[model samples]
Target: MTRSARRTRRTRRMLSVAGLGTAALLTLSACGSSDSDSDSGNDSGSASSSASADQKLTGKVTVFAAASLKESFTTLGKEFEKAHPGTEVTFNFGGSDSLAAGITGGAPADVFAAASPKTMKTVTDAGDASGDPVTFVRNQLEIATLPGNPDKVASLKDLTTNSDLKVVLCDKTVPCGGAAQKALDAGKLKLTPVSYEQDVKSALTKVELKEADAAVVYKTDVKAAGDKVEGVDFPESADAINDYPIALLKDAPNTAAAKAFIDLVRSDDGQKVLTAAGFRKP
Candidate 1:
């Protein structure tokens, strides 16, 4: 073949190859755009689900409650469940501060029933609660010791007088401990506890276990303990009372059930159960 003929044919082949390369680039660019659209659609779906979770109020109701309310609240919670057929009431009982932390850490909770208004204020301050809180019940402190009262803790003054006895108390952060401190301070008495319990239940349990001679725990807790420990009521205790407060959260998932439970607690019937367990009227 002639030289010019061969050169022309080679030039045409090179141009055809370039054209194919341009076509492949356009095809890849189109696929990339399609994938981008798919990702956007998936993100939209995920966002829709999250919005539904925030806007709808039907599922489970979570309550972060004080540890001392374990039994009475448990019974009350069961009643709440029975009253609302489609709803379930779940409880996370612990120290009020610990429960506050759990709720603040993104735990899915619907209500908070604290042993004190101070702890309930923690939630309101954080803008977690929905409305003005009301006191549901009041509880008083008492000295709980192993059955038979071997140490003879008949009076609050005796705690300071009897230095030999080992005593335990709920930490100052807890409602019961705060009440105990107030009662002691009012009496112008200063006594040291061997251990500062994290919660009232733990403080009462220490006495029940015979690990400590006595502990100032809630009267409701003493009644709940039932024979494991003997309760000693001193005169000064009449002055210091722990007020319990409860409310539905602003971000509640089951507001209907949460409000229902709150209503039940405020009802005449609910007050009966609480008063029966030694809680004072609000």
Candidate 2:
């Protein structure tokens, strides 16, 4: 072969190799672009999902509840927090009347659960409730005494006629107190309490702490107190069955969460918890 021909052949082979390298580079670049687009698409999908989830109900919800509801509602609140991440439930438990007064007086609360419809009516009548309150449970009055009933108190008559027995009662302004008054009236009995407590829990606490020999309180309260107090059922108690009502406040800071909490309370699971706590079905 001529020297020039050999050089031409080498040049052709070099050009062929350079063309192959360019094609290889272009193929790698195309693969990289495809991978980049795929990753971008995946990232976009993930972001969309996160945004949708973020749109759900989130934030703090404040609940004003009756003292009798402390145990069951607290459990429901915890379950709510677990079911809806990033949400918190804060509760203020006290006498239904006082809570109603607070709401009517412009207290900032998302929800209200009153032990009686009358107390709830105080809120609804004052236009503090967003809608008509619904009754969720009923509670009956019972005599709570120190464990073992050492006072030998059996009925409402014993509370009225026995002066030596130290007895405590809820204030007439609260639901439990009102119920006690009704029961006493039904029995045509009048008893003077050593002290009038503001709420059923306080009255029960007096019995639990041995401050009082007996207290007129709700059956649920006595059950909650467990061994701390013994419960005595009187026939006159049938005259006063308190209905518990709940509603969303008109000026709820977290309406979504408040509604959700109410729904959970009315759900089957919530009913189970309340019934287990000794509250009767409404």
- Best candidate (score: TM-score): 2
Estimate every model's Cα lDDT from 0 to 1. Answer: 0.86, 0.92
**Candidate 2 — what's its lDDT?**
0.92
Report the C-alpha displacement of residue 92, candidate 1, in angstroms: 0.9
Model 1 Cα lDDT, one tens digit per residue, 1-282: 999999999999999999999999999999999988887857685775466435433457788899988887888888876765666778899899888877776778888999998888888888888998888998888889889999888988888899899999889988888889999988999989999988999998898888999999888999999999999998788778888999888898877668767877888888888888888998
| Model 2 steric clash pairs | none
lDDT of 2 at 143: 93
Q: List where candidate 1 sits over 4 angstroms from the true fold.
A: 1-58
Lowest lDDT block of 10, candidate 2: 45-54
* TM-scores for the candidates: 0.78, 0.80
Error of 1 at 48 (Å): 32
Candidate 2 Cα errors over 4 Å, as ranges: 1-55
Where is model 1 poorest over a 10-residue stretch in terms of lDDT?
49-58
TM-score of 2: 0.80
**Clash pairs, model 1 backbone:** none
